[model samples]
Target: MEIIPKLDDRLKDSLYIQLYRYFKHEIEQFTFETGMRLPSIRYLADRLNVSNTTVQMAYQQLLAEGYIESRARSGYFIAELDSDFIESTVTPCTKLSSEDSSEQKEKHILYDFFMSDIDTDHFPLASWRKYANKLLNSEHKDVLKYGEYQGELGLRKALSDYLHRSRGVHCTPEQVVIASGTQSILHILYQLIRWKNKRLAMEDPGYQGVRRSLQGQDIKLVPIPVEKDGLSIREFKKVQADAVYITPSHQYPLGMVMPIAKRIQLLAWANEQESWIIEDDYDGEFRYRGKPIPSLQGIDEHSRVIYIGTFSKSLMPAIRVSYMVLPPALLETYKHLEWGQTASRLHQQTLTLFIENGEWEQHIRKMRTLYKKKQAVLLETIKSVMGEHVHVSGQNAGLHIVLHVKSNCPADTLIACAEKAGIKVYGTSSYLNQNKTSCSLPILLGFGGLSLNDIKQGIKLLHKAWLPYYKSSEQCSVTP
Candidate 1:
C-alpha cells in the first residue's frame, strides 16, 4: 500500500519524527491494516520529497515500537496489534491544555521552598568546570571506559579520607561503594542483606524516600516513634526488627540531634540483637548551634552500621554522587554478588580531583557559612511576621525548617494558600508512617535556594495568606 505522510519543514519537530508520528497514528487507527506492506523507503522518500535516511529512520522507529516489522527481503509491514494495545497507546488531544496550564502555574511561582533544593548560585562552577575540562582532555580519555564495580578507586579513596576527617566515619577505600544517589545505594544494601534482614524498622516521621525504597523490596517496615532526642531507643528495644534506619545526626523534619548517650545505647541494642543499622547522615556538615556531633559510625565499635553520605547537599545536587560505607560482612557479600557501577565515571574522576585539590572541603565550609546565615534570616523572619501564630523547629542544621502553624486550617490548606500567593511550602504529613492524626499541622520551608530578600518576603506573603485562620493562644491550642 502507498504511504504518504505530510511533511513540514517549518515545524520544530524534525522531518523523521513527524513522519514517525504520522505512521504511528495511522497504524493505531487501523488505517494501515494488519500485515499490510508499507511503501519502500526510497519510494516513500521520493513521494514525500524527503531524503531516504528520513524515511528509513521513521520506518526503523516504527519497527522498534512494534508498530511495524521488517523482513529480510519484504521490507516493512504493519504488525498485528490487538485492540487493547492500540487503545492504550493512543494519546488524546485534550491533555495538551492541562499540561500547558500546569507549566503556566509553575512559571507563576515566585518562591519555591523545595526541601531538596541547594544554593545553586553559590556552587563553585568555575572550579567544577576546571576539573571537568581537565578530565575531558585527550590524555584522560580513559574516563569514557567502564569504571570499577565498587566505583572509581580514586574517588572512593578520596571519599574515605574526607568522611574520616569531616564526619569521623571509620572506613577504608575498599569499604566504600559509590553509587548515583541515596536510593540506588539503599537498593544495593537491601540486596546484600535481604536474605537475613526480613524486617526493617524506621522512624515514625522519617525520610519517606528510604521508606518507599524498602517498601518495594517486600520487606515489612515497622515505624518507631521519634522523640525529642531522636528515634526513641526505648521503643526500638521492643521491636524484633532485623535492621533499623535512623537519621541520628539531625532528625528529619523535627530537627533534634541524637545525644551521645542515646547513640551508645542504640549501638548496644544493635550489638546485642546482632542486627544492622543504616545511618543516613544527609546534611550532616551544616550545624549552626554548638559543635557538630560525630557520626554514629565513628563511635560504633561493633561494625554494625552502614553509613550513607551524599554530596548533593554539600556541593551541588546535579553531581548525583552518593556513597555508603559497608561493614566488612556486607562488603564480603557485595564482592560475591559482583554488581556493576551505577555512577558516571567522568563525574567520579572529576569529584576525585576536586577532593584531592582540597576544593571539596573548602566548598563545604563556604556553603555551611552561607546556609547558616540563610537559616538565621528565615527563622527571624518567621518570628517577626508570623509572631505567636507559628512555631518553628528543625533549625540550626539542614536546609529546611518545619513550622507548626497555630491555625484552624490544615497543613494542606496552608500549602495551597501559599502556592496561590506565589510561594511554595511543603507538608510533613506524608513523611509519617503512623500517628499522623495526633500531630499538629507542620509545614516545611526550605531557605537554601531562596535569597535573603526572598526568604523574608516569602514569609511575609505566607503570613498574609494565612492571616484569616491565625488565632491567639487562647483561641487555638494545637500542640506540636
Candidate 2:
C-alpha cells in the first residue's frame, strides 16, 4: 500500500522527524504488519509530495532505531517487534473520560516548552566534527586504550582550568572525576560518602531527578523550603542531615541565585556541623545578567563542598559527560572504590581538544547571546499579553523561567488548556518534594529549544488560552 503522510512546514519538527513519527506510529498500531515491505524512497516521496532525500533520511533513522530493516533488492521492511515486549516497555497515555474529541485533536504539539532542552541549531557541529576527525586521524595510543577510571587526565586538566577561570572554582586535575552524567556522578559520590542512614537536605520545589536518584539509593531526604533568595538555611539547621544537595548558582525550576552572604553562611554551616555540601552548578555558564555568579564551591574554604558540573546544558546532551570536583578528604575514598571508566575516551579526547583550543569558550559566548535574546522575547511577550494576570521569574539565567498563574484554576488545568492549544507548558507541583507549598501555582516555560519567533507566538497563544478565566474574574469584579 502507498503511504501518504500529512506534512506541515509550519511546525518546528523537521520533515524527516514527522515522516519517521508517522511510520513508527503506523507500525506500533499494527497497521503495517511485521515484515511488510515499505515503499521505495522515491515512490514514497512522490506519494507524500516530499523530497526523496527526506524519505531516505526518515528511513535511515527508523533503521537506526530498529523500527525497520533493509535487505538487498528490497527497499525496507517493518521490524518484528514482539507485542508483549512493546506492551511492557511502552507507556500508555492517560485516557480522557470526556466524550469530546478535543483530546484526540491535541495529539501534535507545535510549540513544546520542555525544560532542559538545548537548541541543537546553535551547537558547534562543524567545529566538533573537525576536532573529532583530527583526533581520529592521529595514531594516538591514548584513544585506542581504556582511559583512567576518573577520566582522561588531559580533559580533567583542561576542565580544571576552564572551571577556575569561568565559574571561579578552585581545583586541580587530580580532584576531577568524569562520569556519564549527573546521575552517574551522584551514584559514585553517594557510595563514597556512605550517607545512607544520615538525612540529606534538599530544596522543596527542587529538581525531581536529583530527588529521585537519592531516594533510589535509600537516602533519607529532608525537603527544605526555598525563598526568593535560596533554600532556607534555617530549615536546614532543624534537620539532622549529614549532607545537603543544592543548585546554588541558579536554583532549578525556581531560578534563585544564592547571594554571597548566603553562600558564606552555608559554608559556615558545613564547617560547623561537619557536613558536606553537594553543589550542582549545572547551567552556571549561561547567566544573562551582569556577571556570572561565583560558584558556591569557590567560597568554601573548609573544603566542605563537593562540586558537580555537567556539559549537558552547555553542549549537547548526547555527549553524556559530567565531572565532579571531590574534596581532599573524599578524593582518597574515590581512589579506593572499585570504579571503572564511564565516559568514552574518544569523546573525552575530542572534548579536551575543544576546550584547549578555546572553541568551547567561543561556543558558550555565542549561546549566551542567543539565549539572552530568546529569554527577553519570552518575558516581553508574556508581560504584554498576560499583564498582571501572570508573574514571571527565573529570567536571570538558565533555559527555563517559571510563570506563576494568578488564576483559581489548578496547575494541571492550565497545562491541559495550553496543551489543547498546541502549546506545552509544564506544571511545577510535581517538582515539589513535600507536595505542600504556599507559593502560587507556577508553570515552567522553557525557551532554549525555541526560536525568538516561536517564543513570541507560543506566549501569545498561551495568553489566548488563559484569557477566558481572567476575563470572567474581571467581569465578576465589575458586576459585584
Candidate 3:
C-alpha cells in the first residue's frame, strides 16, 4: 500500500496534477495494477516526502480520471479489466479482421491449411533495421505528417526503377499508387470502378486472398479455369466480365509461366472486350530458371493491364508496401481517389531506403537462392516418399505448390490426416467453386519456410500418416 510520490519538481498548484500523472504512469507500468489496492493517503505522503493534502488531492484526481476507481469502504483499486481486451488486440493476419462476433466464430480447422504464411526466417532483418533507422532519423517533415496519398515520391521512384530493371514493368513513378498490398490496392480499384457493372474474371484456383479482398464489394467475379498452358483465354470469350485478374508471370496453384503468346492473347481479348487486366506479379523476383519473362504491363501497349507488385512475398508479408503500375487512363482516377486520404510517407520512406540502397536486390538474391534450394529438397522428398501416388504442380517459381491426391482418397480426408500428423496442407476444393467436390483432390503445400531437414522430416510424417490409405490401395489392387 506504499505509494512513493517523487515530488521534487512539484509546487502547490501543479503538485496535484504531477502526483496524478506519476501515479497514472505507475498504474499503467504495472507498479499498481488492476485489482491491486493502492496505499492510503498517510502512507503515500510519508513515502513521497509530500504533504497529506497533496497526496489526498492526487488520489481524488486519480479517482476522477478513468485510471483508477474507489472501492467504497476498502479503498481505491483499478477498475475491472475488460474480459475480451486481450483477445481484441490480436495482430491482423490474412484471415483475422476487426468485426463483430462473426469474426471470431469457430471456422472449420481446415481454415489453417488455406493460410499462406511468410517465411519469417528468411527476412532481411539487418537491412530492414538499417532502412527503418534511416527513415526515423531523416529530417523530412512529410515522414511525420500526413503524407502523399500516391505514396512518398522517393519510394515511388525507387519502385519504378526496380520494376524496370528486375521485373520489366513499364511506367513512371506518377502512375504507381502505393497501397498496403495487392489486397488494399484492389480495394481502391474496387472503389474506383464500382459504377461499372464490375464483373471480375479471376483465375480458377487463383490466389484466394485476392478473391477475399474483393469480398462484400460491388464487383462480381467470374472464375475462369487454369490449364497446363496458363489462364484459359478461350474460356474468357464466353464470360462477359469487365475486368480479368491474373497472376501472369507465375500462375497460382499450377505455377506455369504464361508464355508470350498467351499473355498477348489475353491482352488482345481484354482490349476487344474492353476489360481491365490485373497482373498480380507476386514472387516474380524469385525466378529459379531462365531469363525473366517481360511483365504483362511491360508488353501492355494498349494500357489495359494494371501491374501489382509487393515486397510481402520477398520480404515478410507484414512489411506492407505493394505498388501498382497504372495505365495513363487510370492515373487521374487514382490521383483523385487517393489524394489527401490514403497512404503514409513514413512507410514509403522505410521501403524507399530498402530499394534505393541496393539492399533490396541483395536480400532478394539471397532469398531466391535459399528458396530455390528449399524447393529442390521438397521435390526430392516428395518424389522419394509420396512417389507416383500424387501429382505435383506449380513449384516452378512461387513459395507454394499443389499436389493432386489419387482417386483412392478425398482431399478433406488427406487434410484431416495431415492435421492429425501436425503437418498442415490445404485442399484445393476451397479454391475451386461448386464443382470442386468431383475434381482431383489438390493439396496446396507451402515449402518456402521449411528447411531441407524440416522438409525431409515433414514428408516422413506425411508418409507415415498416409500409411493406412496406402495399405488400403495396395490391398484393393491385389487380385483377390
Which parts of model 1 are misplaced by more than 4 Å?
A: 1-107, 195-197, 435-439, 476-479
**Can you give the lDDT of residue 143 in candidate 2?**
81
Cα shift from native, residue 14, model 1 (Å): 47
> Which pairs of residues collide in model 3?
1-39
TM-score of 2: 0.77
**C-alpha TM-scores of all predictions:** 0.77, 0.77, 0.72
lDDT of 1 at 411: 73
Tens-place lDDT per residue, model 2, 269-297, is 99999889999999998898866678888
* Deviation from native of the Cα of residue 277 in model 1, angstroms: 0.7
Q: What is the lDDT of residue 469 in candidate 3?
A: 46
Q: For model 1, how does the per-residue alpha-carbon lDDT over 258-375 read when each residue is reduced to its tens digit?
A: 8899999889988998989999998999888977889999999999999999988888778888999999988888998787888899999999999999998988899889999999
Kindly give the stretch of ten consecutive residues in candidate 3 with the minimal lDDT sum: 87-96
- RMSD score of candidate 3 (Å): 17.1
